[model samples]
Target: MTERQALVVRGGWEGHHPVEATDEFVPHLKEHGYTIRIEDSPAVYADGAYMETVDLIVQCVTMSTIERDELAGLIAAVENGTGLAGWHGGIADSYRSSSDYLHLIGGQFACHPGKAPAERKGEQADNFVPYRVEMLPAAAEHPITQGIGDFDLVTEQYWVLADDYVDVLATTTQAVREWDPWHRPVTSPAIWTRQWGRGRVFVCTPGHDMDVVRDRNVTTIIERGMLWASR
Candidate 1:
């Protein structure tokens, strides 16, 4: 078998704790026989030669500005068959200036309407909230979630606006509650998979913090998902 490699691009908005979180996840990939390379800046991604030698790219960057060439190289690498995978705002809300980047990934982070209560300040809304994630039939059979069951989490239940081309792996139904004024019933995808050229992409929206990702179910599911998404 050919050797496998993984490049983990971290370091963006410190609020998301990219360094800490990616540090915790690196061991899991290392144990899976992947040679992991960690970068604290986006410069590494701009280097075309560096980006081309990898089998997979695991991004943990959130709300940061990336240069035009750097962003283009990352997208081209993925479109040319380098697997890409990430979770939460890191991948979904990253590079707001780049429309092509969002197009390549198949989803964008919309506002978290459920947490927008007038009484609670900005701090409260971004804090952890309890919710349940429902596994879709298709995801239940997929390798990433095969043994995973419906689980409760206290993390941010992301309400993303997904593209139609994505195959939703799981969903979290955001229910209207007294604390939240919006009473519209809707289902938001928690996990999804999409194909870009010969590459595969898997995204999970449950990892708001390192503590949330430490959950056995979440860790296992993400580890499996990384392996499944890697080329």
Candidate 2:
């Protein structure tokens, strides 16, 4: 079989465990005949030639910054037919300062509200609320989400700000809990895909950590998404 090239660009906040998260899929990428090049920073994105040659990019950087040229190069690669796939804050919450990056991904991490004040213990884990990922009707036929039923997860349920460019596959709703100020439940796209130029972009909002990424449902969706998004 012919070999394909994949790039794993990871690094940012340690809380998301970028290394471990991406590691979970590296072996899978290899099994599928992909030669992988792993980078710890976005600097590699500045190399337009290398970026154009990459068939896929699995990014896991969260709450980080990207330089102007780096962001431009990354965008150009995707627009030129390089697939981009990532989950949780790694892709959705990454590059908060770069609006162009947000436009490329088609979604932004707004917040993940925690349990009620009375239930909190002054820890970040408070945001790990029980939630369900509801697959949309159309997703029943989408390759990335097909055969994946609605599932429950007790993790960071991201409230995303998404645009019309995305094709949402699955969604999660945040209820109006006692502590939450919203009057009604808010629904956010938990899994989505975007087509930019000749490239494909896939984002899954449930991968807050390794365990979450390892969830059977999440794993299947991510694996299929990576392949489906590839050029």
All candidates: CA RMSD (Å): 2.1, 0.8
- Segments of candidate 1 deviating more than 4 angstroms: 114-126, 178-183
* lDDT score of residue 125 within candidate 2: 88
What local lDDT score does residue 74 receive in model 2, on the 0 to 100 scale? 94
Stretches of model 2 off by over 4 angstroms after superposition: none
**What C-alpha lDDT does candidate 1 achieve relative to the native structure?**
0.82
The sequence of per-residue lDDT tens digits that candidate 2 reaches over residues 26-89 is 9989999899999999999999989988999999999889999999999999999999999998
What local distance difference test score does each model get? 0.82, 0.94
Question: Estimated TM-score per prediction?
Answer: 0.91, 0.98
Q: Residue-wise lDDT of candidate 1 within 1-231, one digit each (tens)?
A: 456899999878886788887888788888778899988877787888877888889888998888888888887788778888888888888888888888887888775554545545667345566888899889768998997889999867777887799989888887777776577866888888889888898888888777777888888877887888888
Residue 158 displacement in candidate 1 (angstroms): 0.9
Best by lDDT: 2
